[model samples]
Target: MVPCEDYLVSMIDLPDDSLHIIFHKLESCTDRNAFGLTCWRWLQIQNLARGSLQFKCSHRSSISDNVRYLSRLLGRFQQLNSISLAGCTELPDSALTQLRSSGSNLRTLFLDCCFGITDNGLSLVFAGCPALVSVSLYRCNVTDVGLEILAKSCPTLERVNLSYCTLLSDHGIGALSRECLKLRAMTISYCRGITGTGFRGCSPTLAYLEADSCLLTPDGLLGAVSGGGLQYLNVSSLRCWAGGDGLASIGAGFAKNLCFLNLRLCRFVGNESVGTIAKGCPVLEEWNLALCHEVRVSGWEAIGSNCHNLKVLHVNRCRNLCDHGLRALQDGCHQLAVLYMHGCRRVTWVGLESFRMRRWGVKVRGEENVSVGPSLDQFFL
Candidate 1:
């Protein structure tokens, strides 16, 4: 009685189908769930855009019953393109098997950090989602045989991330190199056993690669980066015995068209490598050379001078740098919005305070830099 008419007037009269379209645009699954429970029409959002599905069994709010209910609700819609079962430990094998056999047109899948999933459970996805373009299997205990089957079957795959997957090694990577040709990106980070030889002859169209901790040498890794038109690369924690020549190969092969490059902890690269990169990649924006022990001020100066459009740079923990390097960065890289100079003891507050006063937008976010100290030998070096 107290303004029921006023509330009704505020609500716009739209068709049920129109309301469904508005809710489907939201990327947040939580918001989607809330909207679905709002009204009967919103609950039927699957009829419009069942593009991305996330089966999160870890969250108590979206329990096992909720997943089952969702499967039933989505059973009618056969056009789902992406499915993310990040933490569904309680999800039965039968449920996944049934979903796959239903002829659902799923293409992208993310099974990040899901523990209950075994090889048997994963096999269902390969047989079902034959048109899959991207797959992320982080923290899963996938073995070589399972990987072979997936690589052989999923020929249309564009990207695959196997980060922190302990069981995977050169065996799986070699198998993939032989079979999968459509892959554009692959991440084998924390796979300690895989050497450089296993990554050869992969996709030529590969644009993104993240092999942070693999023992890939310059030549073996260069095969994947050189021939391909790569745009993003992260080869952190790599140890190359090829010396200056190896690091030079990185700049020679990969720098062109590369937007984001991370050579973190690749301890062998020196000033020569930096010079090559500056000459090769002019449009490079974001770079992380953190802990690359051999980098010097000359290298930093070359980067700053050449990569004028660079926005983000991280040289954290490189002891070779002095105030000269920081000054060069400030002088050349006018567009630099963020800088990480932690562990560079030679870099006094002179250069840092200058940028701090101007508020060079060097504010940190996402993660803190805790390694603030450098050895006594660092300043003298």
Candidate 2:
């Protein structure tokens, strides 16, 4: 009789294409690694199929050794298109220089909390990865010089996240906006040095922006919105009341396309600005005005009157939002679907029940302080 082992069909006997399909189907890293260990042929197929690689520093190993190991892996994965290195605190210029030899296919690079790499290292690495399209340097020690070099090197860049990169300023932003015409999405949240001036004549192709907590001025805000193509904007926690005009400018310039707007934590935003946005942004769908205590009846009425497309509205913690505001929203905002009013102390159960009676299909979510003392019904009456 033939040996029993002869009856077993080896997965290695499958065609290379079939093996590649199997490798792609394995979503977990652990499963992929196990698949590669099946045989040398399977390992080669796994390496060829892999396009993205991520590395995190091992606390048990020395930094230098980890970098050396990383360099070796980079060489082995010559087909890699995306590379992410997180918490590589002491990663040196020489470590990234290895990409110069094997990063011809690299298109995406993400470095988070990699404090040691600077402009020189960036210049060297970008020179090799000229086709890079998306680069995120969160909390990296990079400045305007580095950004300028990146802009010039990779003109095809589309998405960039420089959040928490404190060293960058408007000069770097200007260079990027001028050079990368195809740029679409950018996040500069917590970047205090960027006052929005860098976006003076930025590409109209740019649409999504997150500038929360930045030191934004009126002129800077105008520059950002002047492109007239912004679809999503987040300017939360902006303290400069003068920039309120800039917020209103979004409705003027991006009226045709702006869909999502977040003005959360803007404590000083008054009725005038809110009214302007409501009158102009007819297509505005989702708006977050949480923590905006100054917006009263007029602002809410304007929103209900003009923002017919408003679907999701967040007025959480708005101390001044009373029965009238709720009634106006229920009456005019016909498309209103989801309403969040958490911590709204002034809205009584009677007003809320009245709103629910009218807009029974709408989902209202909140924790109003109704039982603290005498109800706010007397004030509304």
Candidate 3:
């Protein structure tokens, strides 16, 4: 009889197409590694099949060795298109420099919380990687100088995330917006230095923008929204209020395509501006107005009547919300699927029960903080 090992290998061998399909089905890097080590056939399949690589560290460690290891792996995996180096707090600049020579076909690169990368290192990396399409430097040491270099180097760049990069001012962002015409998505949340003037006549293709917890005034935000292609916008916790008119301008410009809007913790925004948004953005699907104490039934009624496409509504911690508002929502917004109304003190069980009975299919989630305190009455039979 033939050797058992040889027979097993022959029997288990899969065609190239079948092996490729199996490799495509595998998502976990650990699984891919195990599959590759199974046999010589699988090793060859893994080499050809691998396209994206991610290095995520949940705990802090010296990633200098890991980066060197990645450089060596890049030689083996020539088809790599994306790489993520997130949570590697101790990663040095020199490691990124090595990546430039190895990652030639790289399209996407994420350097989240890699605090060690300064302007010099990033400049070197960007100089080598011209094919990069998406780049994220979330909480990195990258400054205006770094961004300016990136703008000049990477022309095909589209999506960029610069969240919590404290040193970057409008000068860097302005340069980037002007240089990278193909740029669309931007997440610059917690970037206090960025003023509205930086985004004047910026990318016409820009769709998603998030600048929450920034020092942007209503005028600054309004300028950014004027791009006329914004579909999703979040300017929550703005340093100052520019009144309802600023938001009204945004609504007018983006009414046709705007779908998701988050104005949570925007204490200064009142019913007037929100009402305007509701009327203008008729196709709105999701809205978050949490802690907006000023909004009453009038705003809810407007949203309910005009925003028929609205599916998810978050009015959590709105102490002013009452039965009238809930009833208004029931009258309109038939497509509503999820509702969050925690800390709606004025809403009694009777009103909630009635609304629940009306839209029995909608998932209503929240805990009522009845001033009457915890008692047997809290439970509705």
Candidate 4:
């Protein structure tokens, strides 16, 4: 393992004012105990800093009262900008409720995957967090009524990720979209209750949208105003947009300037849409074309020829990709950092009768050339 000194030496000599900025990036992100005990300087970094204080618990730890406890601990640094107590099964409502009035500077909050969280628990955040800008509630049980209250209360909300909150319907979306003109990013994945009507009314300035596993239709995907800026989109696993031409419409209308595109598991992405995306999105960077059963191997070649800036390519469970397509990506997309090609059964390097070479692929029972593909990370999930 690399030493902390080595890592510290790699970074530029940060000033006192900028140290807080750097500390904000590390204090909540880096290993907590290790970062706290690094040195007196490292320990003091967050003391004077005033940005965000995240108290997330991955395990089944009970920290309801602890949230307020930490606020008291950091009473002097009142410039706290955000707080996230995710997965704290025993987190008390009283402790969190008081933070609304106390942590006045907080702008963002993420309570993802907390099974124990209820409507009343979130109501505290909605009522308290007046200046909130972003919120993520993945796998949490925040219903439409609670979300409706949140939309009505928090006016500064811009980015929201409510993936897996299946109960939130058009009523919730309707209420929120009424005021959030500055909203940029949102994720309603697996929220089958919301459709095109819900989205069109809510987000006029939406740029980043991820609605995977939802019931959003083609009209819903096109709900954004023509002039409205919709850049990054990920709308995979929709049963409504399953036709070949429907996928093409998405390429022609919505995906023109999409920088990040993840259309994995979309039942209708074939050569037509693939070809259109390669031609449309010149500045495309990250792309996930995994589980697209209908997409032909030639589509990747077109993408390689067009999107030169392509970095991450995921082709998981695409059983149709052959050596021809794989070689095209290998030779064309030089900037690809990760390539996921797991479950692509047709992609093999077996000597097809006459073809012979010393650098044959690794001996795998099922996949003839599994070893010949990209790294394992590039190959699968």
Find the candidate with the highest TM-score and give its number. 2
The lDDT of each candidate is 0.70, 0.83, 0.78, 0.66
Model 4: lDDT of residue 244: 48
129-215, model 2: which lDDT tens digit per residue? 888988889899899999999999899998888999999899999999999999888889899888898998888878778887888
lDDT of 3 at 260: 75
lDDT of 4 by residue, 86-131 (tens): 7665565555555665445778787877667688878887887777
For residues 225-341, write the lDDT of model 3, one tens digit per residue.
777777777777776564543566666655467777777787766667778888888778878888888888887888788888988888888877899988999889988998878
With a 3 Å backbone cut-off (N, CA, C), the pairs that clash in candidate 3 are none
Better of 2 and 4 by TM-score: 2
Task: Kindly provide the TM-score of model 2 when superposed on the true structure, using C-alpha atoms.
Answer: 0.87
lDDT of 1 by residue, 219-326 (tens): 667665654567777777774454453667657855487777787777777899888887788777888878777888889889878887787788887888787877
In order of lDDT, best first, we have 2, 3, 1, 4
- Which 10-residue span in candidate 1 carries the lowest summed lDDT? 371-380
Which segments of candidate 3 are over 4 A away from where they belong? Answer: 1-49, 56-70, 102-104, 242-246, 367-381
- Per-model root-mean-square deviation over C-alphas: 8.5, 7.5, 7.8, 9.8
Cα TM-score per model:
0.72, 0.87, 0.80, 0.66
RMSD of 4: 9.8
Q: Candidate 1: misplaced stretches above 4 Å?
A: 1-49, 58-79, 90-95, 102-104, 174-180, 239-245, 350-381
Error of model 1, residue 129, in angstroms? 1.9
Task: Give the top-scoring candidate (lDDT).
Answer: 2
